[model samples]
Target: MRRINGGGVIEETCPSWCAGDHQDDQATDLDDLAHSSTVTALQMRVNAAAPSPLLSAAILQSPYEDVTSERVTPRAPYVVFAPSDDDFTIELDADGLADVIAQIRQHADRLVQVRNQLMALRTGMKGTAAMSDGL
Candidate 1:
């Protein structure tokens, strides 16, 4: 995976055919560093913009039937839940994680409320124990 970064001026080897210009000056070390740096920078940029190797491999191995075969463009599903919170059948990206976290937080609030209600009811029931003893 690679990305063409700013300026699109890939400072790569000027091509072997153009080596006549550098026959003098003993610039071997400088040339090596320049080429290596250019390659390294390109690699870094590509890795930053594109998906990781594991994700790429997963996409490549995906079943053919899963892809839309029709000529018409496929629309995204009408998302009932937020993208961050949806539990996808497939592996989710970073955006998915954010949604999932949001959903978890939302549900946690509800659970806390229910728990508080239950505790309050339990406290109320404690008084009934003494009344039952009198019976």
Candidate 2:
């Protein structure tokens, strides 16, 4: 079901069973309906030579999108947008997730420190900034 609540997010939510892990979940009527609809839509686009929604999402957003290994996963898997706007969907095992979490924490810390330094400079560099340029 796709609907906007108070927040205007276009969420695509299927039944819990329909959204289960592909390796674990067995095929069901709901799955068949979802699959067929998706296939039909893609086929129609192909037949008409119209742009596909899937392809639209994959279009390049920037020339310098960071293609990094360490990215936060909102769910079990991580969906990363590369420099070319290409989406790379990854399934991280326990170890991989742990590594990513650690990396995210480190980056968060660095960001906080950088923000503080910038704020200090903006308010009053004074004794904080050693170099003239930094001030």
What tens-digit string does per-residue lDDT give for candidate 1 at 9-31? 22334432222232331323221
| Model 1 bad stretches (over 4 Å) | 1-88, 132-135
Evaluated with lDDT, which candidate comes out highest? 2
RMSD of each: 18.0, 17.7
Candidate 1, pairs of clashing residues? 84-99, 84-100, 85-99, 85-100
The true-versus-predicted C-alpha distance at residue 34 of model 2, in Å, is 12
What lDDT tens digits, residue by residue, belong to model 2 across residues 44-116? 2567576544311111111112335243422223322221223444434457546656876898799999999
Error of 1 at 7 (Å): 38
